[model samples]
Target: SQTIHQWPATLVQPVGSPLSLECTVEGTSNPNLYWYRQAAGRGLQLLFYSVGIGQISSEVPQNLSASRPQDRQFILSSKKLLLSDSGFYLCAWSGLADTQYFGPGTRLTVL
Candidate 1:
């Protein structure tokens, strides 16, 4: 069965702190990976996405970046955090069928 994993389920950081979130998929190869941020009670916003390793596309211009180092591994990073960055971060992957399966997501709170 295919599965997705995300780390640091919840986070609390002061303003200007560095942030890193990881997501990986099992039982799949070269799937399309995506990063999304959702504000409380708001719709999901696409942050970044990758069709293949080292091929990343940004949908929103913000303080965050994403990298795909491996076929099934995607990483999201920020040099510094902002108060507006507080939200739910979700990692998802889709196979050839283009059906996205989301990970458990990380909740970020910036003070």
Candidate 2:
């Protein structure tokens, strides 16, 4: 029974602030980890993914970055956020090619 946890379910930040969101999985090992951002009416866009420790693949480049330091811990960071950076941040995990489970997601709004 693997599960993921994401913090600060919602956040409000200024135009130029640092951001950090963490996600972790329990009851699984070496699972595929991914970070995605979804706008109001768009599809799920992959930001980053990791197959193993220190092995990451970036699907899209932006002000955000992802790191997988441990087997089950992933961190999303930003040195300075932008107005376009505001959206729904989702952390997901998959053991195979066809299925993935998403977290509750973080709604970030910048002013």
Candidate 3:
């Protein structure tokens, strides 16, 4: 019974501010974790992924970064926000298969 959860469901921030988003999974161990972003009417873009704790791979070079502090916790952060950074942020987990289960996501708006 693995479940994923993301915080703050929605966020609104001004440009140049700092941002922090968190995700956590329950009932799982050593799962592959991922972070993604989806713009308005656009497809998902993988931002970062982790195969294990402290082992992260960045898929897209952007203004964001991710960290795995615990076995089931992932955190996404930005030093400074930008208007273009506004989008739907998603956290996902997968086993050995190709199927990925995603969280509800966090909608971010930059103004």
Candidate 4:
């Protein structure tokens, strides 16, 4: 069975600070990795995705970046975060053999 792991569950940060979030998968190889954000009442927005190691695609250009160094490890990072960066972040994965599985997610608050 495939599963995803995300941490912190919640976060509070000041504007202009740095940000780093991690996600990892189990029970699959070369699964498509994704980073998404959902606002208070907004739908999920894809921030980034990775098809393979060292290959990342940015869906929306903003203050975030993503990377996949290992077969199952994905990371989202920002050098200088903004107040608009506050939201619920989710890590997800989907393989051609399976449907997308989302993690518990992290609620980020930027003040």
Candidate 5:
């Protein structure tokens, strides 16, 4: 029974502040992890992904970065966030079949 967890389900931050979002999976190992962002009424945009620990791939070059510090742990961070960075952040894990199972997303608002 694999399950994904994300923290601080909703956040409101000032512009130019730092951001840190974490995602971890239970009951799985070496799963392909991904980070996605969706603006209000927009489609999900792939941000980053990892096939294994310490192996991260960026799909979009933006103000954000991701790291896999452990087998089932993924972290998304930003040194300074932009107003455009506010959105719904989703963390997902996929198996060999490539069907992504998402965690409850984190909603961010920048003011």
Candidate 6:
């Protein structure tokens, strides 16, 4: 059985600070990892995705970036945070099929 884990669970940050969020998947090999953000009352927005180690694709231009350091680990980072960046962050993984398994997610509040 595969499981996805996201850290911090929740975060409160001031504007202009740095940010780092991590996601890891267990019992999977070379899975396609994804990072998504969901704003209040809005749909899920695809932020970044990785097909393999070091191969990342960005769906939108925002104040965020993602990296896949290992086959099962993905990290989302920001050099400087913004008030508009506050939202629910999700990490998901998928294999050959279309079904994606999601993590518990991290809710960020920037003030």
Among these predicted structures, which one has the highest lDDT? 6
All-Cα superposition RMSD per candidate: 0.6, 1.0, 0.7, 1.1, 0.6, 0.5
- Where does candidate 6 stray beyond 4 Å? none
Local distance difference test values of all predictions, in order: 0.95, 0.91, 0.96, 0.92, 0.95, 0.97
Q: Which ten residues in a row have the lowest lDDT in candidate 2?
A: 95-104
* Candidate 2 wrong stretches, greater than 4 Å: none
**Candidate 3 C-alpha lDDT tens digits along 29-66:** 99999999999999999999999999999998889999
Ranking of models by TM-score? 6, 1, 5, 3, 4, 2
Per residue, candidate 2 scores C-alpha lDDT tens digits across 1-111 of 989999779999998899999999888888999999999888999999999999989998789988999999889989999999999999999986759989889999988
| Model 5, runs deviating above 4 Å | none
Q: How many backbone clashes does candidate 1 have?
A: 0
lDDT per residue for candidate 5 within 1-111, as digits (tens), equals 999999879999899899999999999878999999999999999999999999999998899999999999999999898999999999999988879999999999989
Query: Lowest-scoring 10 consecutive residues by lDDT in candidate 3?
Result: 90-99
Candidate order, lDDT descending: 6, 3, 1, 5, 4, 2
Q: What is the lDDT of residue 80 in candidate 6?
A: 94
Candidate 2 RMSD computed on C-alpha atoms after optimal superposition onto the true structure: 1.0
Which runs of model 3 end up more than 4 angstroms from their true locations?
none
Could you tell me how far off, in angstroms, the CA of residue 35 lies in candidate 1 after the best superposition?
0.3
Separate clash counts for every candidate: 0, 0, 0, 0, 0, 0
Question: Residue 77 of model 3: what lDDT?
Answer: 97
Which pairs of residues collide in model 2?
Answer: none
lDDT of 4 by residue, 30-89 (tens): 899999999999899999988899999999989999989898999999999899999999
The local lDDT score (0 to 100) that residue 89 gets in candidate 6 is 98
Cα lDDT tens digits, model 1, 2-109, are 999999899999999999999999998989999999999999999999999999999979999999988999999999999999999999999999789999999999
User: For model 1, which pairs clash?
Assistant: none
Query: Which is superior by TM-score, 2 or 5?
Result: 5
